[model samples]
Target: MSLEKLPPLLALVCLAVPGTALAVKPGGTLYIKAKNTHLKASSSPTADTLVVLQPGKEVTYDSREGKTPWYKVTVPVDKKGPVQGFVYQANLSVSPPSLEVTSKSPDKPLSPEAFASSGAAVKALGPGAIAYGKTLSRPDSVQQLIALESLAASIDTAQVAEYARAGGLPEVVGRPQVARRSPAKKKGGK
Candidate 1:
């Protein structure tokens, strides 16, 4: 290839190479999506927590590319200057999160402890999500969802490990497996 052609070819090759370039430029801003999340020293979840990032806080994007689950970022701490750390990508968003607090019935506000005790946060589906499910033309979608959730709940850690092994899932082979508590058995059903 000629010298002039090599330059264009190299550029194409670089672009074609996956995970080589940063998704966002270094120093570009990214907002924290979660209410609170830890900025870790490394990409892993078990890494040391460098700082706690709050919702809507802006952090400078450090070098990271492609489908990596973690984003390397520089967060500004009050006592400590700009601290470089890694945050899980799921905890971040490109746009700032809305800080507005909304309630269906403000006149009768629910207590935080009561809400926690209700277990609604984890189990209940929002009306909006249910409506979206309805729109997909499955009238019994809610029932199906509940059934699926029940099925998932019944699966123990051993079952999951066995399934992963039987399916030849290499990714889960060495990863720490979290054991789940067995669901409450029905009375006289054993």
Candidate 2:
């Protein structure tokens, strides 16, 4: 192309550059804090998952921007080199998580069953909650709340995901963005 055309082409390229989606520079390293958190394609929780990251896995990340609760990260996958994606900020930590140990053995990590059975994992309703429940008209409400709490505590993440899938919920069971609804108009009113 002629020099005159080249200048305009370069100007157009520069103008389009900032608007295009591009990966950010590595800001720091972070470790996965959860057992099976996903590296998603976008910042949204329901976005496509690039990979499932395990607890304590190290990943390179870009600094968080604005009020967003997602971090852009590059995770090293087996045989696939490094893959860039967004992970929930809550799932990442600046330092690796120390494995929870059983009371009997300080060196060994606590098994899932052991943790579930431990006193630390099971918490009864506090006196305040019980008192509040007493104020409610339904005398059996407290017992129902206790039952519901027990049921929720017993269900694991895997079980919840499976239940969602079986019930025809969204394929990606990760936290979904809250949709905003427009205000309803009154009859004959614009």
Candidate 3:
């Protein structure tokens, strides 16, 4: 078609801007449901820890770009810039976590342990909690505790291997490196 016959929008679209444009926008919100989740530098668990996210933190999800079960999340450390990192999708929930703290009514008089908050649960089942757990004779509670422990251990091992493979971190951190001996020093620092 002749230039004059072209629609105004079409004419503008024909301009040779000589550049490419890409759009990036947050897709959805994901909540961290498990304690001690790491926001890794990449899509693997072994990636450097960009941030250690506590349970109940909300993050913006952009994409599920990798083969591994990881999500791209944006977290802000400061006003300077947002940190883009990957987190295992297993511990993530599509809905924001609703952690019940306690009864809103003071007159209700809740028990000391009535309302088990997420933070409390995290601390309660922490590494040191095993001793306390062993002392309990409650069958149901014991089973649940065992389940949680197994889940946590499996997740930890899988993440570590993923991070080691993708993040370029050594499987074992802080290993000693043998010093490389320099060939016989030529007379006085040749």
Candidate 4:
């Protein structure tokens, strides 16, 4: 066809296309139903506390920022009763897949008391505390505590290990070893 005819055809096609010329804004409203009464949303998935809600409750939210680009939601406690409100995020799934914790070598002996003590400490102190203690504790317990904390961090080591085995953390491989490098060589190199 001639260029003149092609221009008219192109213009018609552009007009017919929906939301093509006008870019759709990044934001949109979302409505969610509470799958579990205990479910709540947070500003962050890693938040220490959660906002609680009753089952089948609904909430609306918008994005905090484009980067985090998720709706923030809070469930009011006692829909018609007296209770404080709790917060949650939209599009965040409360349920995570299960994971299994297994040792590298099953035959290797483990200290139940030490493991128990470390676990208790981990529970009481949380992930940050356990990570700090891992540095100060003996090598054996440090390894054990790191493993335990990994389980606490997600579902279990088996799950996290899958990511690690898939080559997720190349940056962290030499982290501990870098510290143990010769002080003289380290200073000179730097």
Candidate 5:
């Protein structure tokens, strides 16, 4: 009201002005990476959802300054004014969701034939099937069974193919000689 009060009031206004100006940094862009993402009232997940942000909609948000970091975002409503809330940083990304580069498999899935058992497999079962082949009486048979199991594990498809070729055995079910698929011919060209 008076000149003395005016200086104090002006000093208070000057101190308050810079803090308010620096508080809200109003412009930055980010995209929602997942569907069903919520703009929450706080950083907590249980906080009320202000809006259901769709996958591709653009949103404007302010950068927050506090111990618990959150993005204070604004999303446009249909006819009403924009809704404002915070969103967790995890659900947001700089770019729209693209197909993520996945770690490639070193090889194709193993065929069932890869672990197919040979004659050794049958003998491995013999010791476990009968009571006469107990440990005290038939240690050799038990050892033989363990040996058979080891042999069975080592017997892969390539080994079977080699055995079949050497023993003059008939071709196994999986290995069939079929013609390779040829590319389709174009209508006007070869």
Candidate 6:
């Protein structure tokens, strides 16, 4: 509104603008060696399936897929030969190797039947069963049991029992017995 106010406003605007002093330029290219002889172009680096890229092909890197460190690059060939492999960021950085969970103490082995059943439950219920199982396996208390019962109701009973059995519950209490005879039995039959 006034000359004095205009200088203050201009100074505020400059302060608000970040990195105004720095000359910004386009992003630069990165040169990376293939960590593996063959690398995979996945929808995301964490994807199970990988589109194979042959080793030693120098390709230009492109944008990232989210905040994940994965970089997408273009492949030179379409499914045919004289194919040049492309570059992508597979986020597979080297850190300390992961520790394997090996049983140290001699514990009783799991029954094959129980193992199979638990595996089936995991396949059927996906992450829900896994998460519920983790909660159920915690130190038992009245509240935990109540929570487990609620979670179990949301899952297939057979599957829940299977998981319970596998998780070292000596027996899954109150598992329903399979119905053998029909309710409408022959007249006078005991």
Top-TM-score candidate index: 2
In model 3, the clashing pairs are 46-163
What are the per-model C-alpha RMSD values against the true structure?
14.5, 19.9, 17.1, 22.0, 27.3, 22.6
Q: Is candidate 4 or candidate 5 better by lDDT?
A: 5
Q: Candidate 6, overall lDDT?
A: 0.40
Instruction: Give the candidates in order of lDDT, highest first.
Output: 2, 1, 3, 5, 6, 4
Give TM per candidate. Answer: 0.41, 0.45, 0.43, 0.24, 0.36, 0.24
Of the candidates numbered 2 and 3, which has the greater lDDT value?
2
- Cα lDDT tens digits, model 1, 1-190, are 4668888888888879853563456778888765336676777655666666566788998877457788889888777478787887777777776533225544554443334344543555668878888878777987788788778778654565468567765222222222221122222544
Misplaced by over 4 Å in model 6 are 1-32, 35-51, 78-190
Error of 2 at 34 (Å): 1.5
lDDT of 4 at 58: 42
lDDT of 6 at 99: 24
Tens digit per residue, CA lDDT, model 2, 137-184: 996888888899898889777776668668976333342222221123
Pairs of residues clashing in candidate 5: none
- The digit string of per-residue lDDT tens for model 6 on 61-166 reads 5555576545555444344432222223442221212222224312543332333334332323345555665666463444455676677667754566567568
RMSD of 5: 27.3
Which candidate number has the best lDDT?
Answer: 2
Q: Write the per-residue lDDT of candidate 3 for residues 5-43, one digit (tens) a residue.
A: 567666566554422232224576677765556676677
Greater-TM-score candidate between 1 and 4: 1
* Residue 27 Cα positional deviation in candidate 5, in Å, after optimal superposition: 0.9
Per-residue CA lDDT of candidate 4, range 56-149, in tens? Answer: 3444333343455344444343455332222334323333222223253345433332333334324433567667766774746656766766
Report the candidate with higher TM-score, 2 versus 5. 2
Encode model 5's per-residue lDDT on 2-98: one tens digit a residue: 6688888988997877545433246766666444456666665445555555455566767763656477777774586776677666556565554
- lDDT scores of the candidates, listed in order: 0.64, 0.68, 0.58, 0.39, 0.54, 0.40
Worst 10 residues of 1 by lDDT: 173-182
